[model samples]
Target: MPVLRVHLDSDRSTARRVLQLHQEGKIHHESREAAREQVWRRGHTPAGDPTFVGITNGRRHVQLLYDVEVYSDTVL
Candidate 1:
């Protein structure tokens, strides 16, 4: 299974939104810090990979990344 790493800002709303999205079938597995670190340990870059997603909060907005396979209306 793929993994998604989510980093939210101090604002709790953003994190809630991400959780909601995940539960709503808009995203695949939620990424854990440990999991992400493990991937990095294996010498893998997240960019252009179809098995990882990275979500972060920018200076003023939220950013979302989804695996190509999970970028659809169907749930995982």
Candidate 2:
């Protein structure tokens, strides 16, 4: 199966969610750490940089970015 890489600016909760989804058969991978690391590395690079921004209305809010990838069954 093809491996999918997901990028996100998240916390421990988000990481847990990703793992849960994988265990539930909702995703092809077991966790989001690899994807997270990939994003961080890209952000540190020069070309094709990746960044995450947060927005709020009036109240205080926290947001996270999430990237999900689906793989082919042939490779799974």
Candidate 3:
């Protein structure tokens, strides 16, 4: 089955940090609301700005949009 992907667009360092947090299971976003809230957190970027989030629903539709698996069956 396909999953929802939410990516926080930022500089290389910030992207790496977010990716690390996601991989380590520190961030758990199982819905669109949760993903928007968590992904656009303060201090996510060097200038203390909310990171830009790019979301997509499926895998076959896009080749480069989805980067992180942030949603699950329990959607809000």
Candidate 4:
């Protein structure tokens, strides 16, 4: 499996967008802290870069976290 290393864009607009995605249930993490912790614990390797960070349910659901954007992945 390839690790998706997420890099967050620390800007106002991006924050708003992330919040919106969370509200819409596009982002499964209950909070940014949880997301951060998960990433930290998983350790950012294999992905080798922050631009491709993501977390998955080990099934069909995957969310890709890119700079200033969040994408819901339908295909693994």
Candidate 5:
């Protein structure tokens, strides 16, 4: 898969929305180290090692590092 540099969005609101999705269960909470390994599951299974989610993106890293808590993730 082609890597997506999602940190391109500088709007804080957009990042906040992602956090809302996680809280509302619309999205699953993964981790911030996606640039090192696959971080999401495809489809809507919600039953596995990694949680299922929609389109796979680098949001997990951003979410972990910013919206949710203080953390570090490998830069893409």
Candidate 6:
């Protein structure tokens, strides 16, 4: 955690997606591990609610926290 710094990508598109997910029950308040995996697997995670992004400070890859979650019923 010491090497990682999270700066949320606040875009209108991302926020709009989050709102839609919430309304459609696509977003879930799940564990951070899954959220982490989703972002870590891809350099940039899916943007929704709290958007995802990665910043590398030299050799260190910043791990962004997914404050919101998506449903498991459907594949993201």
Clash number for every model?
1, 2, 0, 5, 0, 0
TM-scores, one per candidate: 0.30, 0.27, 0.30, 0.28, 0.27, 0.27
> Per-residue CA lDDT of candidate 2, range 1-76, in tens?
2233334434555545655564565642323344445644544222222222221122333233434332233221
Per-residue alpha-carbon lDDT of candidate 6 for residues 22-53, written as tens digits (9 for 90 to 100): 56756533323456555445444434444333
Cα lDDT over the full model 3 = 0.37
**Candidate 4 clashing pairs?**
4-53, 4-54, 5-52, 5-53, 6-53
Scored against the true structure, residue 31 in model 3 reaches a CA lDDT of 33
- Summarize candidate 3's per-residue lDDT along 1-76 as a digit string, tens digits: 2233444333444444544665675542333233455434521212122222433334334211223333234333
Which scores higher on lDDT, 3 or 6? Answer: 6
Q: Which ten residues in a row have the lowest lDDT in candidate 3?
A: 42-51
Quality of model 6 by C-alpha lDDT: 0.41
Residue-level lDDT tens digits of model 4 in 1-76: 4444454434444455665675666753433544454455554322222332333323433343542222333122
lDDT (0 to 1) per candidate: 0.44, 0.38, 0.37, 0.42, 0.34, 0.41
Ranking by lDDT: 1, 4, 6, 2, 3, 5
Q: State which candidate has the highest lDDT.
A: 1
**Cα-lDDT of candidate 4:** 0.42
- In the range 1-76, model 5's lDDT, one tens digit per residue, is 1232212222345456655676687653333234123322211212123332222345443323322121233233
The candidate, 2 or 4, that scores higher on TM-score is 4
Candidate 3, superposed: residue stretches over 4 Å from native: 1-7, 28-76
Among all windows of 10 consecutive residues in model 6, the one with the lowest summed lDDT is 1-10
TM-score of 1: 0.30
What TM-score, to 2 decimals, does candidate 2 have?
0.27
RMSD of 6: 11.9
Candidate 2: deviation at residue 61, Å? 18
The runs of at least 3 residues in candidate 6 whose Cα sits more than 4 Å from the true structure, single-residue gaps closed, are 1-7, 28-76
